[model samples]
Target chain A: MDDKVSIGMDSRRITTTQRETTRPFSLKRQPRLGESIIQGFLLFCGVLSMFTTIGIVVVLGSESIAFFRQVSIVEFVTNTVWSPQIDEFGILPLLLSTLLTSTIAMFIALPTGLAAAIYLSEYASSRARSILKPILEVLAGVPTVVYGYFALKFMTPVLKAVFGEANVNIYNMASAGLVMGIMIIPMVSSMSEDALSAVPRALREGAYGLGATRLETAIKVVLPAGISGIIAAFVVAISRAVGETMIVAVAAGAKPTFTFNPFEAAETMTGHIARISGGDLSYASIDYNSIFAIGLTLFLMTLGLNMVSRRLVRRFREVYE
Target chain B: MTTLNDEIKSGLPQGEAARRNVASRRRTGAIWRTIFLSATIIGLIALSLLIYNVVNEVFGYVATEYAVDPATLSDKPIDELNKDELVAVLQDNMRANAFRTLERDKPMADRSESEVYDLVIERVLKPQTLETWTLRDSWFNKAAIDAQVASEFPEAKLEFRSWLTAGFLTTPMSSDPLRAGVRTALLGSLWMIAITILFAFPIGVGAAIYLEEYATDNRFNRIIQTNINNLAGVPSIIYGMLGLVIFVRTLEPLTSGRIFGADSGNGRTIVAASLTMMLLILPIMIINGQEAIRAVPLSLRQASYGLGATKWQTIWHHVLPNALPGIFTGTILAVSRAIGETAPLIVVGASTFIVTDPDGPFAKFTALPIQIYNWTSRPQPEFAHIAASAIVVLLVMLLSLNAIAVLLRNRFSKRG
Candidate 1:
């Protein structure tokens, strides 16, 4: 339809006189009613994103409210146990596991990811950086489910060997945390590298003039300058780690425990949701609603982290500019 | 000071303290640099490890013992046998109830040659896997494996089997790992991706056009911009929750094919999964589209305007064509993500063990990643082997799509 209309328009236009004028200025084409329709359509499409947000909030809010009615929000927030199969509505255990996994992941990812960023920005030759950077991103391109299997088959066994098989369970948080950390390394490195490279070269030259070596300048001057970006990277990576599902589901068991021991098995919020939903549960069952309730918590947590990261990035940009 | 001056005048070496300081500082620098280098290499290591681990699981040797070898019965090459012949073999060999139930579940008339063979192998012979070893271990430790197999399962026959075989690809999901395949999940993934692109592409491009060309930098535009960036960061599992509530529950009539009067009227269908994926990739698509459109040279637009073309006409004729390749690059990346994602579908109720292929948007579905996840989580090690095979398929699909995008980007760049 569009092609036919366009073709018709091309034939109807008289080309003889229009081509004669090599006008310096625009000829002021008449604003047709069709233009307004197109504009409206475009604007409507843009507004769909906003509708998506509203949809998310409304859906989560309505279901979460229903969940709250069945289980008190205060108790859900404060209670320590999360045995939903037996009617315990404590959100603490899952929250703890989420926190524990994210913390361990951050610990592994932050320093190593930052070091890689520093290397790419300040140390690696241009040729090497070009070759290495995309290879690093291939890690990000990998599906999370593959990482889950890795954690299950490889990382856990390696951990078992290190910690002794008796100490590390077949399904444990250590493997999940380490693998999750590895999963987010590209996010941290890529973002931090961008921030690191954005720092003025003049600052490094100035530091060098003061007799600081490359290592000294990078750690003291460049890192400080790009600290906000690094922080933003950390926040975003943590948000990613918190929401990660399959790694924890496959490697980390479904048992929700309050213990923070990395060797023990635990379930994350996303893990719990995957497990419960995989089975047959009728609509509006408490078991069914609990997943939503857990999902709502996860949604808010990631949202908060994202907002913080955004704010940090904006602040850093403002300061630099 | 006098001694240092005398040494300098005589062209002598420096003292121990200064030499030690220089050596120590250089050593520290080397150490830190090595640390950074190691850190950089970790990503590469992780990628290799992932590939190695998944591929390692794909091919291997398994020790299997059948209840009754088909050779004991009449055999005119089982492969050449008709479906009826295979069914008769199953009926004679297996109990009446099991055979009848299997036939009643999905009629023998509909079953293909391979399916009949799979049924025969799975039910009649009941070739139970006694033990298994990876491809690497199987080759190097052939004698050891043979000894172990002899010791463990004396009656078992050991065969070098590539888990990702033709039959594995052709069969449907089954309770027995040996017979299970990704046929249903692959169809679901393709269908879901098709629907996702259909819904997201036009809308995403329109949004990009509005943001890049039409909208003024007013507060409303700023809000929309901020909202998009924020949406891109939202966890995909959250999108699943939104999908479960909105598409699955709230929009059941539309999503479940009830309105269209199609069979399999369930909200947790391909339509819902597709819509969820559409939401998941919508922000990414819009952002990439905006970048693609924004990259079109301003000179092109100016020339079009100078020729008396309206804004939309200039965009449609000149700007869009220029941006189309970039748009395609981004769309490919988004499509890969949509195909690989499992968490959102799991939340939106993609079945763990679906057998039948998803026929349409409103049919119940299971994607490749969901299948992989389900198989991996099973206690049976055989399931993990098949899951690895599925992962290989999924990765090939994803990486090839990305490779195409990269190629397109390169070609377009060269043209520019």
Candidate 2:
């Protein structure tokens, strides 16, 4: 039925347009009820995602509002102490521990993951690539809890042997960070590979044709083209490192302290929540509210990173495209 | 005349020419490429070894406990009455092996007390198995085995299932590794994952379609875009804390209903935990869906529009079908993360033990990761074996889910 109407319109327009001017945009006037319904559904989906953002902000924000009212911003920010007892509540120690662990995890993840990415994307043979890709993905597939258990039973013992029993605390941040880095290797490498692969082969060929080596072409032409993606990948990986909890909860002990020593036991924002929630706390209490407050902080940090990374991805695409 | 002699001398040094010849350069290039490829292969091998080590350790226990000791299994494999028959035969063989081991360790009564004691009688007299054996029954009695061991040879260390069994899935945790079960935890995981998918998929897919199709590329949309990305990165535990504060504490009035039986004082119900995870993974779903949507060729949209279709109609009729692959892929990724997550659930007060499966979404529940953690942390070494087996089960489930996701993505994209 619609095909008949379109055919009618086409014949009428063809006859009328023989002498017509200003008819280039005539197609915009068409009625498309079926099309509208599909578009409407898609729009509804998009709007719903936006609401998720709103929901997170409102729910987390409202509860955290109560927490800030109870504890002064200065005490939470300035003080290094994090007792979270009846009289004292501080977030500084948790923040510091979170930063320290994430930083350490990045330190481990960046080199190995980048190397693996380069090897896989640029150097590895097709046979090698096919076999290696799935295996490395298996690392990501293992649940963090399994990693935590392995860290406690296996990784800790090996660390103790190397660092000695006295120095290597069972719940130090290093083991957790190291294992967490291994867990996220695929994320960084996979994203980096995507970024690198998106760099035009024309650019590499141009460099090579100019007598540059493969490594030289990658370093000078291809990597620069894909720098924005690499940066995005790095930022995303950092966010992942910060968000990681199970390994930290199990391998990194739940002693919230404002210290940078990787060897010492520490607790991250997520770890604290895990520990506290595992136990009991009264509902509507200030301590419970603190969880929301910390969540708000984590949310803000990650939100900022994601936005920046997305912008970087757009800019990176523009540069090459 | 001298030029001819010089030319001949210059041409005649064939030995020097042979000595100066270099090896084929392509072989050297091939060797380098081979080395580079081998390094990548090594990385993969290391990963396999890691998995192999964990599986090997866990299964070693299974081998000891389950493997039939051919010497004492007088009946053929089919002659056994039930599943326990093989275990019984294995036990008898284990007892005989113990006697042989003891005889090697010590001599007669005058020689050593270990040698004079009965080994076979102890295990055979009282065959006690772990809850794993609850699925099976042994023919021997406890006191009888003790007396038989004392009267015969008394030098044997009894072994049950080295690894965990299905009984571990059914039993609530115990102080003893032999008695621990993950039945409650498994049920909890099911409830949590089911609720999470129900809540997150709609919101996530909706958000993806909205951002991808309808919303103009304006500053507000950009902000929303940024927010979703960041939400994906936020540590999941924060969601747990938010759930605790919002659902357990502030909203306890709604959740703490006495519908199940008693007011068991469990504040963080499965519903609350599920919502938190839903929030945590929503961003992932949106982002993945957006990518899928973006991949659909714009030409299809133009064709629909040219046929007198509205903007919405064009997207619905022409675009969405093309983007189905991305939607499924994104949904799978989001669900996978949701299933594996343990930290946030821990934060929201998943019970360490609940004898019964959760009665409803509001009922308190335990999950597999929580159960595994509880077991592994215990002082007993046997519980570690249980944890390993549980880990295996969890990995298998995750892998299967991922496989399904890949299959869907491939099937849809292939249609495109």
Candidate 3:
């Protein structure tokens, strides 16, 4: 029924185009004034998103400029301490912690997410896929704040038990990073699954025709073919990890320390912003301005990754089609 | 084909070697399959563990020590006391000056029985929780906890407490975790979300309509499309910064209701937060709305046009009705996302503690997630228990919203 309607619509469209060409002297239908006004209003609404982007850039840029005037770029980049109380503003510790947590998150999410994607796309029956997909979505739908609670109340204690109680701080990057990874798994699995499923069925058939096992075909041909999309998913997940605030804020301690140890409590850029802002700060103070600078840095990092991910996703689509 | 098969068979490793190779490969396959399945199971386990961790803290054994025992205050029981009796209990126990102050604040004669009862409990009984234990510990180590509590606080009374009680839902915020409830925060969240939907839905759908139905392949439209996509990926905190600079400061007169002479303190009003949230979720709404609008088949639009309907008429009459369910699903999902968002609202200056319920958009507000974040950060163990209870509330709210969206989508898909 639907196909027939579409076919009839297509024919009508063809006839209309033909009529338009043949009757060039006929009056062109003009939209009513009210219709044009509504269209204009809709267009404004469409362009409103551009204004939002401009607003974000303007806000971040202006505040970051003010922040940079007081603190030298070299000191901000290279100095180890981030004590806003003492007028010291170095971004290294926060940046390092952000990188550390994101790295840890990536380490957990990438392999597990890819394996889950491969399993769902290549192995799971339709009924299993239907059941499993929504469960994964439920994982994603859980609030970040809940994950923060889990990180602080649950993950930290478990981490403490495994690595002696003395070694793990009550609030550490490891617990936050691990929970953030769990939060990001659905993103990775879903995106990678889309990419894997988009790989043409003929390739799988050809591999099977050559006596290749399902596992062999999936690992060799399908994985390579969907590699770009999987990479894009990884990039997006990493960006999400880098930008995640609550879990890190709740579990990772507010102390800005340059430490490689995931067990040690250190603040990420996002966490620092959340923690400092949550406290009462006098408006336009150096401490307040410093959060904007950190936010600008985070925004740029995530934006860059998102752009790269978009390009990779686009490239993947191009290659397959 | 037969000759090629024969050639391939001749070239292959014969019988036992080939069997061993195939068997080894099969074993590896089975092992890898298990590994992959376990990865999925790990995700499921993590989710369950998260739920368990929250549930474990929400219900437990609590030991309380009061300044004056309720049994000593009432002939029967404190709970069974009438309003006048409760008021008398409060007037007798509290100082004369304090009693006058309470009367001055609100006359006890005018207060309800429960209100008077609560007042007596607050001013007279002053129940202070001495210690708390998790549900698991309460179940398995009951004797241990009992002995510890008995040794530690001989005068304290121990009882099982479900932190998420009706009182927990109705009572306002308090510094004392025992007295604190999510009433203010829940109202604030609902108010902000209601306003957010009002602003975001139409604008989102309008933007989507323009993009899907009316957009010509032009540079401006392309820019708008790309901007919306990028805006969705922009860290939510940046939007908070935008709200801080724009709605909170630059547009303070408008957001704070000063222009309207309402005397809201600042732009940290519910309206400000809702607008900020509107911007944050606008991209998501527009994207989802676009998908929903796009899903309204071309045949429907063409049929309407064939009947001499204008674009707007066609969209209103046919496309919108067909797409309503999809749009609802998208909006609910977006609203849930907005509801869960903590970072942006925090940056936009949600009050960490607010007692009075938000009565209007201009009022200062706290949200459930912000409350949870604040509670979890506190040093007190009792705060963690309350935070877990709040988490349960937030999760249930989000889950129900999601379930509704899922049901809508399922029904729509079935029909489509």
Candidate 4:
């Protein structure tokens, strides 16, 4: 069936070209078995994406309704404490922790990622770019689980050594957030570099022609031109940082407390879901449904960020064209 | 504009001022260049540090002492014991029900004498990990390690163990970090990847075909395109939620295989996880497929039509074959991304530890990332060592898959 559809779909390109040359084409042609099959298959595939969106919404909404029926939506959203074990289902604690970790990660990722991007775009020779890009990609490809392990085993020990044992907790958010920042560096760098390179050489030449230094030109001209794409990278990286699970699961303690300190261990939304799902919860329990509510919240946050990213990417494309 | 040296020195803007301008600009450029180079260096250093950290734990000397040496149980060497003798050793040593449980998990009748003997060694003659040394310390301080072992643990065995052994890849997860291996997890990962590819590939390609070839530029198609792009960036854990409510609960009868009497009726089966992964990666697959198809040149299609072949015939003969290589590259990358994905599987109920290999699509499963996560969560130092080794396995798989992607992309780019 797949082969037949591929053949059918590819063959259509030929017929369109043939029709243009032949002239006087009529719309009322007899339907064929093969053409109909290909069309049906393609349409089915396209519509399945819509089905996936519906599946996500229906599943999340139904379970969230069950949760909100038992726990008020206003409380779930506004309450500061999140002790499901004690029957207090406040989401603010988890939301705050997620924000804290993502913020720390961005603080660490943005300057380094942007600087690396600028370096690659404006300074590196082609040979240097070729060698460095693939290596950076390798860093991106390292599994998050490995990063989690590195956070727990390596980074924690190093931090303890630096701050003294009394200052650092075994499962602090600092290590997880820092390691996650490292994991996203390549992602931000490559993306911003892509944007920076797309900034027309004419702009850079115009700056240089006016007696501007390379530093002045890159900072004043290219950075401003690629600002939308750089912001998009930041949003995408933040979304990724918020959604990361294993690093926080292994290093950041599953305490889920509302706190402003980065050194203390606290659960993010993804970590909470992983922690709850790993335990054996009986079917249809409120605990099970609570993860769904959290998931719904998480889904909406990422969706908004992704839409912003998409808009930014489109703006970046429009700048040149 | 020519000026005397005295005028320029007195700060008239001329040759000296212009030279200073050029020199200062060059200085600024050099400073920025150094800064950029350092940024690249910092990234490279971090990457190297991670690899170094993982590799540092894969091989080391472990000081171990058994409760009762198997050597004392039999006059003959433990490995040389006959099947009946090994069974006698196990029965004599282990509690009756514990023996039964082992047999229940994997039947004794099916295992070789060596296999049962190894189990006896693992379960009955349990080796307690006394002290551990990192790969670096074990190499440089071998004499000190030996002296400490001799003073503290006279009866203990001090041996260098490479955690990534053939047996490690062949054995199952265990409570003891020394005996724990990744056989079950490896199989689960392979099963999940297989099903994900099977489901996502055809559907993703079909969608790309429709969008690139058949669909007219309209509101609906534009909306579909936007949704696909957004879906590509959706947090993977959200997909886990979708899968849990859809595959694991709502469609349990279908996913668990209870309708066909194949599963034990547990909704959190390999089939459910695989399907979740399929959905998670479908957007990436569709976008990649479109890119590959769009790369096919228009001249090929026109030439094929000049020969009077229909659309499908032209696609099959010219455009698709050219696009196929690029498509493979994209699929390979998507699969790599899917395999490394831990968040979705964790939410979809990947087990922390499962000792038995999965029986089929509907069987319970745990993957390598989950195992690595589980091991790292344990407080024991030895488990951290094992976690490091598991990371080596995961990295090898990810790198090889990505290498294939890079090679295929280069191959296709050359041809196209």
Candidate 5:
């Protein structure tokens, strides 16, 4: 199928060319049977993926609509207390917790990840880079649940011991956010490293010839060139942090109270969904449907972030080739 | 671009002052680079420290805890020995150790034999030391202890056993370290991964191949592409809710419809969870697969057609083989991701209490992450040891799978 399409497309290109080929188009048309099979395979993938998205939207939308009918839109959106046990199943606290963790996570991750990217792209030798890159990526591969356990069992006790009992809780957002930050560092490093490497070498050499130091060249030239990718990395990392659940569920306590304090326990949308579903909530109940409503909000936030990053990446792509 | 300083600096480069300035600048640049280099090294060391912490905690249990000396057992046939003989052998060792300790402390002669015997039992049988506390090995049996006292140092030879052993794999979790094992959880994880792969692969790849090879680049294709990228970024927990609605409630009648009059689908079966994960990663697979297909060189298709092959023939014979490497890379990565995912599985209902191995996709199941979460949530100290061991197993599994993917990717890249 691919061959037929390519051949048909290629023949069309050939016919339009000023110089004509000897082979007639009819000979190529014979391959259409085989081409259609390949085309069918391709079409199947596209349609299946399309159906999946539609399935998600339809399933989520219908349930969310059912939920919203019971819980007013204002109460669900604006209220600070997110006690689903109450009549008002507000999502504000979950959103706050998600934002607090992801924001703090990015605050720690962005600088370290970017610096690592710079060192790999500009300073490190090939031997060092080959050894280090995989080790860095290993962070991403470690299951988030492991990080969750480490945060709750290891990090929480250490935080309390060092900073005092009043400063930390067993399910504090700080430890979860800190460990979550560590998990996201590799995502930023790898993406930013690729972007920095993609920056044309000519730009670096030109800066060097003009008497700028390697550090200056990296900061002023390579960084500027890779800014779009850097932004994309941050955006993706934040989205990842927001979407993360097991870590927050295990480490961050299930108290969905709105608070700016990192030392206190909080809940995220993903965490709440896990907690609620794990409970014996009946399928037809408002709480069950409310999960769908919260899911829609989470989905929309991440989708928005992904779309923005995608646009930024396309706009910033250096046509070096 | 011209300045007095530029001319002076350019012209003075041949002199000592210029040489010193250049050397100083070079020194500063090297120092700055050295700092950056050290930071990278430091970052890696931190990662190593984290791995070391987990490994140390796990190996520490395997090392100091519950490891009985094999020499103590002396290859005794316990089945031939009666219960009375077993009791006699145990009592003899109990008396010998107590008497020996009493002889060493002559001032304690006023103490009763019962008191001395109780002390002996506490010291030998109790998990007094970390080593003695974990001894569940075959060597820790009464015969083993009797033989060790006779052959080895009469006083110094003692049973050191592991609290965790092969039995840990078969047993359910208990408050006591001796009873805790991951058998049920392991079976659950195996079933979960098996079902997840079965569901996710065909649909994900099918979606990928369609978009890459068949679908035209019209408004519809653009919409599909946009939707997929957006779907890829959506929180995984959302899929769980979708599954709950679609599989648990809507499709309950079909799921509960048993052919042999058995309860087939309880809404939390492996099928529901697997289907949910499949939906979650479908976008990822489609996007990755599409990229893979797009990456296949245009010349391969042209060359295949130059031989007078049909369109399907060209794709099946030439284009697909060329694209397989990239597709494999995408599939492997997607699989790795699905393996580690915890949130969606949790929301979709992975039972923590599943004891038997799943017979098929319809069976209830759990995963490593879910098990780890269950273990870590509890307050028991011994559970931490098992949790660490479980983590080691999980990491090793993920690492090996990722290594295979890397190997496959490298091979494909070379071929391309």
Candidate 6:
């Protein structure tokens, strides 16, 4: 009915335009005042996101300048001690802790996430996919704070029991990192599955036509084709692990020590910021300013990784279609 | 084929050896397939363990030792006592000065029956939990728990307690874990999310409209697109830092309600947090909204245009109605994400000890996640129990929101 009405209106408009050829034709082309205003409003709304980016940069940049003015760049980078009470402000310990946890998280997430993605994309039937996908999403939807609770209450105890009570601290980086990995598994798997599913079926069939097994086709043909997206997923997951706060803050202990041991307790950059800022700090205090410095560092690190991930997806994506 | 001849010259077997090689390869494939299947199972198991852990902590057995037993305080049960009787019991047991002070704050005569009864129990009965056991422990190790509680606190009564009781949802925050509740935090979360939606929905949808309908392919638009993508991936904690500087400090006059002549102290208001959340989730909403808008077929717009409708009219009358369900699904998902967010709100200064429900956007507040975070960080075991209950509340809220989004998507997809 709507289509018929539109056809009728189309012919009526054409007849009217043919009858009144003297009227200006360009008037309809120009946007009316109300149209322009609405468009301008929408454009402003789009620009608002740009403003957010600018705000983050300006806030982080300005506060970080204040922090660097008081503490030399060399000392901040080179010094291992992070005792703000004693006027020592090295970032190495926090940076190392961040790296340590992210590395541990990657160790757990990468293979498991990849395997799950391959299984879902290559092996799972549609009925199985429908059931399993929502389960993974529920895993994804469980809040990080709840994960933090599990890390503190459950994972830490299990780790202690497995590794011996003497080896694992109550608030170790391993428990936090392992739980962070668990928290991000769905992100990794879903993204990698998208990448794997994008690999054309013909490619998989070609591998199978050569008498290749399902695992071989998935591993050799599809995995190589979707490598860029899988790498993007890994990078994005790494950035997420590095920036995760509550799990580390709740379970990974607040002590910012220079250590490589996952069983020991130490603070990542995010954990430090969250733990310190959660406490009462007088405005403009050095302690308060230091969190911004850390935030700047974290922002730059994650931004660089995300940019790389985006570039990988755009630059290396195969035009299978 | 040449490699096969080379292998044959190198003393490789022909038929049986080739068959064995194929069998081994197939076995390896099967083994790896099992590994992959188990990987998926591991994720599901992790989810189950997380739920089990939270539920385990939410209900259990507690040994309570009251300073004054409720049985001794009244002829009838303590709950059945009238307001005046409860108030009289409070006066009899309490010091004169303390009772007078309570009456001075709010008259006992003016208080409701439940309020008076609660005060009577809080002050007079003072049921203190001596020992708490988890649900799993109470189930499997009941005998052991009973023995320990009986020996350790002979005066204490052991009873199964569900921390997530109806009363738990209605009460306010208390220093004592037994008396604590998530009412204040839940209100604050609702207020923040409400304001966040009010601001973010329009801005996000408008941005999506501009990107999809109005803006042509250009450097400026592409930069905006890339900027939004990067902002979406920016560490949420950095957004918290941005909120700390921009909303909580620079915009103190506005966010603190000083401009409105309301005496909300400082800029750590729900408005500030909500705006910060709006910024954090805006990219998500815009991206989702863009997808929803893009999904509206061009033929629909063309049909409206063919009917002598303006571009805006086509969008408003035809495209928007068609896209509304999708937009709602995105908005619901974004709001659910905002509900669970803790890091940004913490930096925006969510009060860990707030008791009063937030009455306006400018009021200081705590969210459910923040409450859980604060409780879990405490050294006391009971706080963990309450934190788990709060987790249950947060999960239920998020799951319901997600279910709505899913249902909306399913219904719309079916219709379309």
Best candidate per lDDT, number?
Answer: 6
> How much of the true contact map at the interface does candidate 1 reproduce, as a fraction?
0.78
> Candidate 5 residues A1-321, lDDT tens each?
999999999987877783464644453344456556657665765666567667778988888999988889998889998876667687889999999988888887888788888999999889989999888877778888888887887778888999899878779888888888888888888889998998998999999998878888998889999999999998998888999998899988888979999989998888888998887778778887888888888878887889889999999876777
Model 3: residues >4 Å from true position, as ranges?
Answer: A1-26, A316-321, B1-7, B70-83, B97-107, B110-115
In model 6, what are the clashing residue pairs, if there are any? none
Worst 10 residues of 5 chain B by lDDT: B127-136
The prediction achieving the highest DockQ against the true structure is 6
Query: How much does candidate 1 score in TM-score?
Result: 0.89
Per-prediction DockQ: 0.65, 0.37, 0.65, 0.57, 0.47, 0.79
Model 1: per-residue Cα lDDT over A59-92, one tens digit each: 7787788899989999999998999778899999
* lDDT string, candidate 4, A55-96, tens digits: 898988989999999999999989999888778999999999
Clashes of each: 0, 19, 0, 5, 26, 0
**Model 4 TM-score relative to the real fold:** 0.90
- State the lDDT of candidate 3 residue by residue for B1-416, as single tens digits: 99999998898978999999889889998999988888877778988898899999999999999988778887888878787777788878889999998889888778889888878878888899899999999999999998898898999999999999999999999999898999999999999999999999999999999999999999988989988988888877788889988999899999999988886878889999999999999999999999999988999999999988999999889998999898999999999999999999988899998899888889999999999999999888999999999999998999999999989998989988
Candidate 4 Cα misplacement greater than 4 A, ranges: A1-28, A313-318, B1-18, B69-71, B74-120
Model 3, residue A208: distance off in Å is 1.6
Ranking of models by lDDT: 6, 3, 1, 4, 5, 2
lDDT of 2 by residue, A25-136 (tens): 4634666676566667656655554665676688789878899998898887787888876556788888888888788778866656665666677667788678788877
| Stretches of candidate 5 exceeding 4 Å from the true structure | A1-38, B1-35, B59-165, B170-177, B254-262, B412-416
Q: Per-residue alpha-carbon lDDT of model 6 for B251-280, expressed as tens digits?
A: 999999999987598999999999999999
| Higher-DockQ candidate of 1 and 2 | 1
What digit string (tens of lDDT, one per residue) describes model 2 on residues B1-416?
Answer: 89999897687545656344323234554564455455445446546645654564454311112222333445564333343453344344565676456446653223322212222223333333322221112124444544544555444333334355666666665554545666777788888899888877776766777787777889988878766666666677767766666666666756565554446475678877887788778778888888988898878888887887766666667787778777877788777788788887888788886677787787888888888777766655556667777787687788898899878977776786
Residue pairs with backbone overlap in model 1: none
How high is the DockQ of candidate 6? 0.79
